[model samples]
Target: MQYSISQDQNGTHLDWQHKNVSPEMIDWFWSNMEKGFLLWHPEEHEPLQWVIPPKHGNLIGAVHIAPQTWSDGKRQNLYIRFEDFNSVPDAIKQYIEYDHCIIVAGLGFGEGSLHVKEPLGYRIHQWQSDVQNSNSVGVIGKSNAFGWKKSENHEQGMIWAKHAGTEISNWGLFLPQLFDLYKVVKNTKYNPFMDLSVKRIDGVLQYKTAN
Candidate 1:
């Protein structure tokens, strides 16, 4: 929820512990994440589904998976590209390369490496930052299915909302938007969905958030 991103003298860092990493991998991740922070067993809610060590967080540059991605419909934790952290200055790059992708007519996108959802059927939303920026996803969807739009009144700042006055509202708002716009079509195949705004809850980051 409270995702951290920063840079340092040695380089830029974005660290967070994961219950899905291994001792060896954690060591490798931390060694290079000069400016990254990782809290093992993090008390946050992230859509990432995997079993990593509660060790150091990963750098945007140096983590690697042998297979890259999966073809079968299974959740993947390898969205963020570890290789990009190799930047000499450690600054997070704005773009990266993508090699694998699914082929389709109306909906087709390359495996954005770090995007939350697979890009097989959804229409690509935008050009990726680079071949190594597996840290986040660009907008991805079809033209009619759930789509994203900027809120006219929106500005720049951390935001929060209360559904029954609980923090869960932050993610609840995100889940539906993803499903209705992308995942829903992932399984149900529909159109005309919705969009969501980036918001924050007590410093925690949520869908569409940039800072």
Candidate 2:
């Protein structure tokens, strides 16, 4: 599916429509993202594990290390740190509608020493609560999830936007099914028996539907 990309003084913007996204999907994203990410987009994404798992089980201050294949075909390792939404400056907050939204921010960096390397940029993702468990929430701008980096050129920004849009769409497609399996494990005393596999259909890798 093709997603739209636009630009303004703020930065490059991408608008994607992911239908039937449930609250369970959101819960899965925050908690089991390391697993779900590869399941959703096996072609593009590499394994992303937490370098610093959430302290006290809260997302704020958690850190993850991952590598991304850029549009330029260069793979770069990224160290990302999640931050509190309240710390966002007013200038950026003005453009975001925070009411009833799951507001999240991440500080991104490329390879090299943590203190020595310049920051890649900040990522702000805000999703409306109402969009969850709703159908036909078409083109909701608040659900747009992509990082707008300060150092990236317009071309690079668009590439990232497109990549994010594709990833988000894939998650929306398979999350409900994945969430059902997750509930089974939770209910059955953490049964370690899951027969999940990825299959390629029409050149896109996707989770095989649970029988």
Candidate 3:
């Protein structure tokens, strides 16, 4: 599969040609693209601050997201933000924002489809353990994040996950692993997230999602 990225006044756009790309994948890509656009212009929303605990003398950086308030009064937002931990000269003292970050997780495309990972659900399970050990905030709420696996071959794609509040401790520890996973999966020739365990499949290009 071949893909290209371009930017215009409208925002960044992705164009690709692939044989096995599925309808579900196209929908996933477009939805994520819209979310990306919103992040750049999140002036109207409230920024939620995330704080992770210190580990081995190194403190993970904080994360912020502008959550959209629903008509029913639910505040929710789904997006991706990546920060480089190694670049921080002093992780113990810095609180970095999303302004300098990139979408390193939560979005992927290959094998003729798009993939979104729901590590937050897995995070919730970890949080449960933390709560058992008295290391968490102990507040349980509906995960602002919810989705299903896109491909049949992989047990993991995007799944459902519960979201704890912004002040959850030790949550930042998951960043490095998640980022590494993103780097590996996105660059692989075959989409491991897809069924058939193949990256490029023989099929037809019915149409293009974006020109």
Candidate 4:
């Protein structure tokens, strides 16, 4: 998809033309793209700030999130922390104090085109409780086996995918290289796991329905 941006008296504007694209989809695309551009060029955009120290030891990654206004005049923000779920530090939890947050994690895959089925877990209990405290909010997981409560309030919700394709691909491609780089930089042992726990659920659904 191609997109164009223009600025006028009425703030900045974005225009895009693509077949079979809905207005809502276009708005979502534009919003994410704008946020991504701001993230990629942090020097140019000062909206996103690093609230915690980045991991520089065996793992080389950083955490960054940006707050922006939604079209409905409501404030919303996304949090991104590029580190192992198990290795997240406590200091960074303060940055994710938003009323609504979505925690997306990729469940690793195992053999036979099945989800790895690891125990579904969250790093911060306070946030989980906060989400629960808000009666009008709840969490949703791709796999219902996860311990997320269902609620009537659909307006505010959190979703987790059993196997997020983009995240699996990203970790699959980046982790090996990162491990190798870490070994060389820190003079440590390198253990690479080529198993990417991901499968396309759409195809599975179609096959099941057809069969």
Candidate 5:
């Protein structure tokens, strides 16, 4: 396992990686894991594997793990904030009525979505876009970051509506893995532990191929 635990005033955050992980290891992490988690897709596997822990307490925010498939046929895996997944800001929760996975708000603690916290707010450096593109992909929430545009092009992760009292981007941009997840499954509400903890969450996301 690989990990990095850091410290700040509000609390201490830990990030780590584990190799040869099974289902139990993943259970331990989500249960004992810190509040901050973000993984990247390994960038090698065509499609990887990932596991989503059951709803932990109140999910503050979360993103599907990424860098997901770069191991020896095992798979690459990364992290997304837990808040994004658990907060799931919709009533019907139809981020994709067809798919079943919904993108919720994240640490979007400041300007981007909602959440008034300072440190977690959307970082100006992390937020960028090109007004140049007048074309987008969807209708409801097209432009990423802050839905800055009213057109269509490649608004990769703009899927769900935001929960009130929060300002985090609940959109799941094409993180390579999620892009593939969107293509394959029935949804992303994964609670079944098929003994996979060190795999990419994107590949793990369960989607049903349209018959």
Candidate 6:
């Protein structure tokens, strides 16, 4: 696992790699959550439920609610709404090529996303507070503060950073096994293990078979 902290802001960047874990596997985990989340972090994460299930397996506009326990020992319900890389602001987009990134919001703290890049790793970016002077980025409550304010709740941000690392790191332990099983499953209605390409049309993320 690899991670970095933003010295000037309240954000965390994490990356983890697991053998044979493809982007499709990541999609499958989100498309059929609950079980995977529980497996990843049984102690801090509870079963996740869809507030609004995806349409035809597309994750954009899909909403999921997960009960999570923070490092502060506070339990909070996160309502995450999935979006596409297009939703990422230009300020951040200019830094990286996010063609296959899965963006999300409604964390009540900030915004975040999952990006799978070359050399094969899962990149996680959690912006726990406002960015580019725009409140539109995060569309949730601020009760937790998400450690955005450097002076006030920076410690809370640190806790979140460490917590996120632990969760993603745990994924490396089991995802490879799950992927192996997925490869052998036959007679399935859909192949969730196949690599899919992401395209943004008119501001919405659309998935299609990769060439």
Best by TM-score: 2
Model 6 steric clash total: 0
Between the candidate structures 2 and 5, which one is better when assessed by lDDT?
A: 2
Estimate candidate 2's RMSD in Å: 11.0
lDDT of 3 by residue, 79-170 (tens): 33322333212311122211111122222223121223332211111101112324322222111122222221111111111112221112
Give the CA lDDT, 0 to 100, for residue 85 in model 5. Answer: 27
Q: What local distance difference test score does each model get?
A: 0.22, 0.53, 0.25, 0.26, 0.26, 0.49
What would the per-residue lDDT of candidate 5 be over residues 49-129, giving only the tens digit for each residue?
Answer: 223344433222433333322223434233334333223323212222222222322232113333333212111101112
| Among all candidates shown, the one with the greatest lDDT | 2
Instruction: Give the Cα-based TM-score of candidate 6 against the true structure.
Output: 0.62
Question: Tens digit of lDDT per residue, candidate 6, span 1-211?
Answer: 3434443352444433333344445555555565477877777988887776765445666677778897789886756666555554443333333334455554443133222211111123321212322433221101111221123245655676666667766655676567566566553333333223455577555556632
TM-score of each: 0.18, 0.69, 0.20, 0.24, 0.21, 0.62
Deviation of model 6 at 128, angstroms: 24
Q: Order of candidates by TM-score, top first?
A: 2, 6, 4, 5, 3, 1
> Any idea what lDDT model 5 has?
0.26
Candidate numbers sorted by lDDT from highest down? 2, 6, 4, 5, 3, 1
How many residue pairs clash in each candidate at the backbone level?
31, 0, 5, 1, 50, 0
- On TM-score, the stronger of 4 and 6 is 6
Show model 4 residue runs off by greater than 4 Å: 1-36, 39-46, 53-61, 77-80, 87-153, 157-211
Model 6, residue 56: C-alpha shift (Å)? 4.1
Q: Which residue pairs does candidate 4 place in steric collision?
A: 109-197
Tens digits of per-residue lDDT, candidate 4, 53-83, equal 2322211123344454433344534343333
What lDDT is reached at residue 75 by model 1? Answer: 29
Which scores greater on TM-score, model 4 or model 5? 4
